[model samples]
Target: MKIAIIGTGYVGIVSGTCFSEFGHEVVCIDKDAAKVAALCQGQIPIYEPGLADMVAKNMTGGRLHFTTELSEAVPEADAVFIAVGTPSSRRGDGYADLSYLYQAAKDLAPHLTGYTVVVDKSTVPVGTARQVARVISETNPTADFDMASNPEFLREGAAINDFMRPDRVVIGVENEKAATVLREIYNALYLIETPIVITGIETAELIKYAANAFLAVKISFINEMANICEAVGADAIALAKGIGLDGRIGKKFLHPGPGYGGSCFPKDTVALLRTVQEHGVSARIVEAAVEVNAAQKARMVKKIRDALGGSETGLTIGVLGLTFKPETDDMRESPALTILPALIEKGAKVVAHDPQGMREAAKLLPDSVIYVENPYEVCLGADAIILMTEWNQYRALDFKRVLATMNKPVFVDLRNVYEPNKMRAIGFEYHGNGRGHEKR
Candidate 1:
């Protein structure tokens, strides 16, 4: 199978590389000359575990190729996947901007040779697959192509594994031929008994947003429970475990944290809320989840400030991690976005460190917050330390070193990395999530 993956962003690159690994001749087309050149030279822009190795392996085997010309690449391909970015509209309507998708449809229309399955691999709105089909029909009246919505559910850190062995593959297609092509494309995973859910375009589109919204709701629910546990002197972690043990509640995304923030959850939740509002139904729970997550980020500032005995003015605060979650360089909608600003407003200078997010974080964060190379480096000369993202390094830190490095040995573990007694033994004040000031 020859596949042309348009838009060489995270999804496109990962999908194209995986397809090539599956023995398809994949041509990844992107408009950015620098990015295409970088990919051609084995320089991957995004950091996903196992992605570079997969890309390298495919490229070396001559199954994968990168190009800046879609006009040249799209014609020879049997399947053209529009994996472009559909970022949230700036107007805050929660609608994804379909400009890129429409452009790709128009561009690929004239070159649609035979029965080409044009897949909308990007996270798009419900009617987007129809819109793409309509655009293709209008541009090239004789083009024989079927548009399908195949939304990706891969997390940033574990993208390659997710692609290699997805729990299920949902493909929305109108014709039998189109469905057959999709099945063949995913045949490698099919042998492993990965369920292939064939649904309508609208349902498939909704599936992505609905899945993300549910995860966001779960995180927010646990976060709210953490707050209640703090007030009632109960442990949120234990409560989560107790509830999660039930077969109905199978424990995943149940960990209480600062908030749910990344590329997907926040944006998708807002998008779902917008979609429901347009349909005259209020998605109250999801709306509350979004609100709670936002408030949670702001609340983290107060948590750190209280740990330092109420004032942050002229204090040096250390942030152990800056990424939204561990094992990825993505900082989009990270809690640090809100918490760091609050720290700066209160006259506290922040020093942050992450295993991989520093380069990206440097652009978003102010210069006042120094980007350190190591977690222990962030702890040095700090009045109080806050664990923002629970990276593996932050989880198993030398507590003695952390205490020795800081001017004041105060640890505010937002991810509950350590217990109070453990920090106390190391001669440092510790604050775990859902644990009050009495422990500090």
Candidate 2:
């Protein structure tokens, strides 16, 4: 199968590479010439685990290619995938910027020589499939291609693995022809019993956002429980474990932390809420989830302030982990973004460290933040240390060394990495989410 992937961003690049790996001859087309040039040199623009190796291998094997021109790829391909970014609008409405999608439809529609499958691999609104169909029809009135919505659900850190073996492959098509092409394209996964959910175009679009929003709601719910646990001296971990063991409540996305961040959850949840509002119906649960997530970030700042005995003046705060989650270099909407500035505004100097997110974080954080190489480097001469993201490296630290280096050995464990009693026993003041301080 020859596939043309429009927009070589995260979804497009990863999907193109993975599709090529699945034995399809794929040409990834991006409007950005510099990005296309970088891809030509085997330079992966994004930092996703195991993606570079796959991209290089597929490109080397002649199964994958990259280009800046749509005409070069679209005319020769059997399928065209719109994997472009659909970032949220400023009004917090569920509307996405469809300029690129529309442009790609117009540009490719005129060049469609045969029956081509136009798939929407981007996370779009419910009626976007109809809009895409309209654009393609207007561009080439007699074009024989059919539009299908196949939304992607790949997580940033574990994208490759998820793509290689997804739980399900959803296909929303208007006809048997479009469905057959998608079914054949995903034939590799079909053998593994990966359920192929067949639905309407609108349902498929909403499914992606609904799935993300539900997960976000789960995390926010646990965080809300963590707040209640703090007031009642109950342990959130124990409660999560108890609830998670139930067959109905499976043990995923139950960990109580600062809040859900990165690119998907926040954006998807807000988009879903906007969709609901546009229909004049209130999505109360989702609205509360969004509100609680915002409050959770603010609460983390207060925890740090209280740990430092209420004054941040002339203090050096050590922040460990700048990425939203570990194993990926994505810092969009990371809790550290919310907490770091508050510390800086209160006259405290922040030194932060992450295994791979420093470059992205530098852009978002203030110039006052000293980007350190090691976790211990940030802890040196710090008044208090905060674990913003739970990177595995920070899990096991030389507590003695950290305590020796810090002016005040106050540890604000936002991810609940350490036992409060254990930290207290080790002669360090410890504070964790939903866990009160150990009595002196």
Candidate 3:
């Protein structure tokens, strides 16, 4: 199969590279000349584990290509995937801005030379596939193409593995021909007996939003439980483990923390809520999840302030991890972005460290944040240390060193990365989320 991916962002780059690795010819298209030139020189713009090497290998194998011109790849491809961005609207209404998606459809319509599947690989609103089809038909009357909704389910940190070994492959098509083309494109997964869900365009689109919104709700639910545990002197970890073993809850996303934040959850929940409300339906649970997530971040700020003895003024705090999660450099909606600024506003200076996120975090976080090369550097001369993101490096720290360097021996474990009793025994005033009942 010859595939033309219409964007070279995270999703597009990973999908195209994985598809090429699947023994298909893939050409990734981008409007940015510099990005295309960089990709041609094997310089990947985004960071994902094993992505650079995979892209390089596929390019060396002559199975993958990059270009700035759509006409160069679109006409000869069997599938032209519209993997462009559909970020939340700037109007603050929680609606997704689909201008890029619609424009990609219009641009690719004129270059269609044969029967091709115009797959919507971006996470979009329910009726977006239909709108894309309408845009393409209006742009080029003679275009021979069929619209399909094949929304990606890739997690940012583990996108390549997720794409290569997805639990299921969804193909939303109006006819057998379009479905067949997509199945062939994903034949690598098909051979390994991955479940292929066939559905209508709207259902497929809704699936992506629904899955993300549900996961966001789960995270919020656990965070809410964690808050309740803290109030009643209960242990959140024990509670999560108790319920998670019930076979239905199954323990993913049950770990409580500052809140759920990343490229997907924050915007998707709001967008899902907005979509339902626009259709005269109410998604009260999702609305509450959004509210809870915001409140959770605020609660974290309060947690830090309380740990600092009722105020953050004139405090020097050490922060570990800035990205929403580890193994990826995305800081789109990281909880640190919200929590750190509030502390800074209250006259606290923050020194932060993340293995892969400092460069990007420096741009989103306030300039008052001091980025450090080593994790332990954050602990030097600090009033307290907060574990903001649960990166592997922060999992095990030499507490003696931390205790020796800090002006005050206070530790706030936002990710619940440490046991409260053990830290206290080590002579540091430790604060962990929802561990009020731990033996002290």
lDDT of 1 by residue, 210-324 (tens): 8898888899999999888888788888888999999998799888889988889988888888788888989899999999999898888888888899999999999888999
Scored by CA lDDT, what does every candidate get? 0.89, 0.89, 0.92
**Given candidate 2, what's the lDDT at residue 334?**
95
Sort by TM-score, best first.
Answer: 3, 1, 2
For candidate 3, lDDT tens digit of each residue in 160-233? 88999998988899999998998888888989999999999999999998999899989999999999998888
Off by over 4 Å in 3: none
The TM-scores of all predictions, comma-separated, are: 0.98, 0.97, 0.99
Worst 10 residues of 1 by lDDT: 431-440
Q: Looking at candidate 1, what is the lDDT of residue 225? A: 91
List where candidate 1 sits over 4 angstroms from the true fold.
436-440
lDDT digits (tens) for residues 1-440 of candidate 2 = 99999999889999999999999999999888999999999999888999999999999999999998888888888899998888877565546777788888888888787899999999887788889889999989998898899999898889999998998888898888889898888888988889999988899999998899889889999999988888887888888899999999888998989998988888888878777878898878888999999999999888789889998989999999999999889998999999889889989999989999999999999999999888889989998999888888998998988999999989988999898888888888888887532322
